[model samples]
Target: MNKQPSHASEFLWSTPDAFEETKIAAPGTNLELETGAAAGLYGAAEVGNNVQSVWDIASSPEMGAGEDIVVGQKFSIYRCDALLGQGGMGKVYLAYHTELARPCALKITSPGKLTRGDDLKVRTAEEARSAAALIHPNIVTVHALGEARGRQYIEMELVAGGSLKHLLRREGPLPTLQALRWMSAIASGMDYAHRQGILHRDIKPENILICGRGVPKLADFGLAHRIGRGEYIPRGFVCGTLPYLAPEVIQTGDHSTATDVYALGVSLYYLLTGRLPFYADSLEDFTQQILTAPCPEVRELRPEIPLNVAGLVSRLMAREASNRPSSGTEAWHLLNSVLGQLRDVQSILDEALGYDPTVSWIRCGEKYCVRVQRPDGRQQRVFIESSEHRSDEQLLLIYSVCCPAESSFYETALRMNAEFSHGGLAIREVDGAPHFVMVDTYPRGTVDSEELRKSVHEIAEHADQVEKWLTGEDRN
Candidate 1:
């Protein structure tokens, strides 16, 4: 018996497949439960964990309706092909006019999600009517508004390019100049609308649509109400996206042109940082933070952001609505003035190359040659090229850093290139030698001096990492 115990211990301790049994539950706890077989089924309402279902049934006599229109289904004159998007109150579908052979966006009301009264239907029609009154190049065109089978729907222009929100989600942040350009365009659109006595209370990124030509167009004027034209928004009736809501608007639910400016400023902040300034777990917390918290410095988050640009954005997002720009036109002019003081990319690069203590750049025809010393005491030649496509809105800046391309590191470079955030490494043959290179591109006019420096630093750091990896000396 002693030998047997010893043998068991040896097998348990030394064997590769041996494992200890583990127990998670209390030693004396009862885990078994009573069970029955072949029982008759009960109603869905009588099933397990039916508290929510029971509450739903007790609250309403009839449940809400499901999606009414499917693919190829005709609600009225329009044939629904695909669903573009949906919201709490309705869904926007891609539909085509049967008679006119035109494509349009059909927004239909979801009766159940809206108020029990006819307010939503009325508002849906009002939204169409309000937008229909305006005929601007930067506004979405509304064709018709009608009711079909007791459901309200509106047919409008089908904007091919998605909203700025989608782009912000894909790309972390935008270049300062590009963001300024888009903001200027939106301001121009809203200025025209304000002149027409329409107040766009909702002016967030989701409401700005980029067209095929990269031109920003103001959209979703559903929350718009005509001011100084006998249209009165009842006091204490708040209507706007919460994050962009002005302090006065949140406190009293009174929206004004200043409210739109505040929202535009918030949108600008979002475009510059790809995030909201204030975030909270609850509505109370959010309201408190937004109304009371001091605004964060934009340059702290993006040091590359120009001081004057940051100051303008900060002023636009001031807590007091009066502190903001009086009108969108005025804001546009302010941005133009600030932009006028900023140096062009070529000039900045030339200045960086000329007088910068750490870096040197020389004009070599259309391309600029930047000389950089790597950390390992190796010298690297980076070529900069700025090209403007005839159709592109901004100049494209390309930077290429050249190195000897080893076939063993070619695959690694390709992989790194695919995964890199700013740019990628490539293997190009130059005079019978494989040249390993890293390439990055940025918009020319938008790349500020600080941003340019950061890009160069990032490229240099990446080149160092690549060289180390190639030499099998990578410590990371």
Candidate 2:
């Protein structure tokens, strides 16, 4: 009897997400089951994300040596040409469209990035092909994937904001609203893939790109695969960033939409607090923590975290398979519910009955900016910025209240004390008038787009609160 070949003989398996093609399952591996009755062939892919399937695995696969790329080469796109950058996935040349006069990003993978031997080459091709099939606003569109001069390359949209890693490292965690805004766009992109029956196994900060316009584009579908089909990932390998992997991914190699949600939740936790839910004091502790430890409570780090927001992400971090949100859609809803009621810090302070800080008071502009130690002996500040734009939600998590630094990103939703800066904090009047002014501009992120937006919003919101408090007292 002739054995049927698994649909494993194709490169560029198209389903969803931008980078789903990198993970390929070995189709002809052996499996010993049930007391060694009969060895079976297993095609369990270690790269869990639905990837491109390619047939015809030759003994020797094609590869591009890095030295092969020409300094200025062009690729064809929709009625145009574009240049590629000389970086990862081969030299990415910058290209421009002549007819449309549009610029595009083109990349060619060098053979060096694919050193895992014969089967891995086939898998890489599948990844390129799969990524080629994905097209979304939040996804860098793969214009095409093909080989030139024994080198395989892909053409994609050139987003301006650069990588999320660059942004986060530069500025730190985003304002709650900004992070949510980016997450929503990312979810929409993931939703596009799920609609097409694909799961992004490698959902980490690095793979998510931020466009210059602050739009989030989910890229790097190099490890994606179909729902099943031996899962098309590398066998016995969890191919993704260590911090974002779901519990199931490490245990049984089972992946689905829930896996993506788990990763997103982890990303959000890192985003809001600028800290991981589980930090290992050591390597052993790190692995063990992933296996059995629960994520830290958001409130424990920053008291300002909205209760609904914390609980929402907490549900996604559930260890049990059945407990987490079924899909990114559900996660999106939960996120919105938590973020819907945006309020200024003064209101929150008023509701909390206000706080009195004992420290040095320095005048920032006209308002007083007070610096004080938190209840946990950590230093933090409570100041306000007035903004009609963010009258709803006006606070930021500069850092953990448990570990506040002399300067942090966690600007309070409260008003800044403008009387003095003697080290501790207190709200005092200036010229017999209540006015909270924020005058600190610490560069948090590597670059400052998100940070700038956050600061401007905080400053405006702080000013608004001072005006409100003054008006309310006048009426009384």
Candidate 3:
């Protein structure tokens, strides 16, 4: 609700090679690597090895020799058009299918800098397999995985709008309603993936891509792992963005549905505010704060945020995993419950006046102004707005102007107010001038379609009559 300074990153967090060898096998399989060898595999920031900032990767002008896939280069029936982005893992290009002429995102593996035994090609295939297995509307569709010129690649659906990180960087914090909608949709996709025994180990804003019309599609399964697998990673090997890593994952090298939910919670907090929950000068301090400190109340920064929504965010970012929502399904339901409590006046007005030829309305910011044509051919404009009373009760205020407030007409307006049975006569300032306004009030949460329709018609008719009687003109 407040316009805070933008802290969005211009570059994305590069996926480090530490997670390349992180085993992602089928369920019921035991995949184990020596702790000494894999000790820092997941600890990108802790290791301080190949963890490059977004700027470092974005500033690189060229890829390593034999790793660059040039534009217009035909590779396995796909023609590379332009480079979308490059990170520690690989370079993603906008490509097209030569035969079908279909556009897609072509992600090519960059295995030049990987550590020994870190088979990036195998990891790339695993990423494709893990993502391709589950098909959902919110999940980015993976088409195929192949190889050309010794470089492995994945073909995915091309999302034109780009990633959530880019969106936030360009357009600071989003509207609470729009952010909630996107979060709920992403939760549905995560629930589907969890049901299929997949854990999206990485669930940051950069990994979530936005499609046309604001549809959020979960992308980047590079760190995804199958559930129920024994010893999925060596202890102490953390594998996720430092800011979004769950406390349990940071303390113990474990990944679960709850961990994913924790990351989603952190992502939600970032969406609501323009910055992360905790900030520190170094990764160790940041990790320590996450492990020991309680998350600050979201409402502390954005007080206008609803209590339920703020509480949900707190629960999602609980230091203990057991306190979290458990899975995306639970989170989705909670988010929907909050969404259900929100009252959109514009939507209510639309439902009330959509089919009436004599009624037309336009929304300006949070308020709606409707023009109603009375049966007598006179037109009056009615305004509907949401306000909070001193008692903190949310109310819908409906009003229409009658005429300028003059000392001579004060007694007549008071007399008419007593005669009226619906709304009362009030003097409110309009364009810096006091005017006699016919005003009505209703509880925002309980205002219904029929009541809204009746009030709009009555207020318009009454205000038009008053204007004609007092001023003998059709001026508002």
Candidate 4:
């Protein structure tokens, strides 16, 4: 046998395959378990062609319950119709309720492994109890427990979308309304738990879930615990998401609500910029960045961020808890303000970018020519004409000018997005007339095609208000 080693220096342990493997322009460790074409462009969480919608599942004692199982394998629960993801301590599967058929995340843990580590005991037990105790819309529910064939595990809600890590990797940073909508949900849940005397000591983005664009749920409470009561909880050993842990955790060896705030700040920064504020080669380097580095400014990254939003982000990441909002209600109000501004931006983008024509009109003149300019000073040209101009009967003409003739007019005229309402475009030769053709989604920035349409439509309908509005009004 040939004993020569091949790349023996390669580390046995590695980051998430999906994310770490994919190269990105940002700074951070890859939590992405997989990469798709969408990740290459928009990012991971939003990569899938289809979006997932979830049915509301109730919270009950059954949620906390689960059946046990051995390590080194996955257990499928037919009732839940969900596959639990694998984990280090054990594996967790998604299961549905027997009677309700509600979705749930069922975790399978081996008793043999649990008995082996005293260190894992607190967080492990707390995962079940604290998650069960703190009930909220944003938190994943632990439904029930069961055992079969020498295996044991607990059942929880099946949050269809995977972790936020997957979401961010698949979908780029979410739009503002969606981002804040989710943050509000998470903060509210954490606030509820805080009031209930619990703290998610291990709050991190990996523990967060983006069920869809707006749906977010918290997970992995194995480190959750009753705040004040955990005083005697095995001193010396530290636990929690490293990047998010507060400075106090490093210096004083004490954990507090302020620490949670710090983590929240980190999460907010992540959603806004799609980049971590601080990135390092190792955990120690990460700690250094968190402890010493000044929080990066959001406005500098996304210059379009509103004044209030920039201010709010700055305040949340103030490196001082005293600067943060007093209560969850206050945080919600601040978040609401930011979300409002973000909603306006999205509304503008949707309105400015979408087009739907209520009526059809024909252009039968050589004067109506399409001209487009590219970023590189390149120009494209296209001309449209109909045999006879008509008002009521609809006729559409699309021109795809090749080569130097690649202007914006043809691009805009050709586009028809399926996701939103679009002007119904059908290509049919009208008894010896030219074809009515349409184009679709563009590769990057909007071409002058849209602007050119406004100019031409305006010139065509100068006299009649109806024509002007019909041509320029729906600009979408």
Q: Residue 203 lDDT in model 1?
A: 79
Candidate 1 similarity to native, TM-score:
0.59
Tens digit per residue, CA lDDT, model 3, 10-104: 11233343321122222112111111111111112222333343323433443464456678898789998876655444566778999889998
lDDT for each residue of candidate 1 in 392-455, tens digit (9 for 90 to 100): 2344354554457766666777776776787677666656877666667765433446567767
Q: Choose 1 or 2, whichever is better by lDDT.
A: 1
Poorest lDDT segment (10 consecutive residues) of candidate 1: 31-40
| Tens digit per residue, CA lDDT, model 4, 1-476 | 11111231211122333212211110011011111221112222343422210100111122223444433233444342423443233444445555665655555543343443454444445556666876777877766555544444566665556666566766888665456667767777777877887766656566787565435677656556577664442232344544566666644445566667667777777887788777766544555677788877877888876777768777666666677765555565566555543433123223423352422222334322444332333333333432232221212233322212123333443442232142233344434544332222211111123543543333222212211222333111
Q: Is candidate 2 or candidate 3 better by TM-score?
A: 3
Q: What is the lDDT of residue 181 in candidate 3?
A: 71
**Top lDDT model:** 3
RMSD to the hidden true structure, all candidates: 23.0, 15.9, 14.5, 17.6
For candidate 1, the C-alpha RMSD (Å) to the true structure equals: 23.0
Candidate maximizing TM-score: 3
Cα displacement (angstroms), candidate 4, residue 434, comes to 62
